[model samples]
Target: MNEIAVKSNPRRQRLLQRVRMEIHAELEAARLQLQQRADYHPTWDYFLNLLMRPLAPDRLQAEVGPSGETFMQFGTV
Candidate 1:
């Protein structure tokens, strides 16, 4: 490849790396802010738990049992 092409590739790669780093930093900041909000607000923690509850294994199994037995239906209740 020509020298200009080679130089341009590395410059483009460096720009991509910087952009990725900036995005990573922004995500980290957002995650930290969410964690801070969750920590400071008991209601936030409870709401997160509520959001996650339906995905819980026992909840899923109880809501829609894995087997024919009715036992699974009572697991989460």
Candidate 2:
């Protein structure tokens, strides 16, 4: 469980490097596909926004009120 031991092991290092490479490759593929197909770009944008929402300071502030209560409003059909 030690971080130093995990990084020092040759097998673990290889496994970690392989995993990082695989993730990078997949992201690149997705980017290429998104660029070639413009129709799904909105969907991709929505997905990215959702993924990054938690990290946006303005979004976080808007979602949580001064009393520390979280609220979301939806429009009626």
* Lowest summed lDDT window (length 10), candidate 1: 56-65
Residue 1, model 1: lDDT of 25
TM-score of each: 0.39, 0.41
lDDT of 2 at 32: 67
lDDT for each residue of candidate 1 in 41-72, tens digit (9 for 90 to 100): 66566665554555443354545335655543
Candidate 2 per-residue lDDT, tens place, 16-50, comes to 67776776676667666775885766667767545
Candidate 1 lDDT score at position 62? 40
Badly placed stretches (over 4 Å) of model 2 are 1-5, 39-77
Candidate 2 vs. true structure, TM-score: 0.41
Best by TM-score: 2
lDDT of 1 at 34: 77
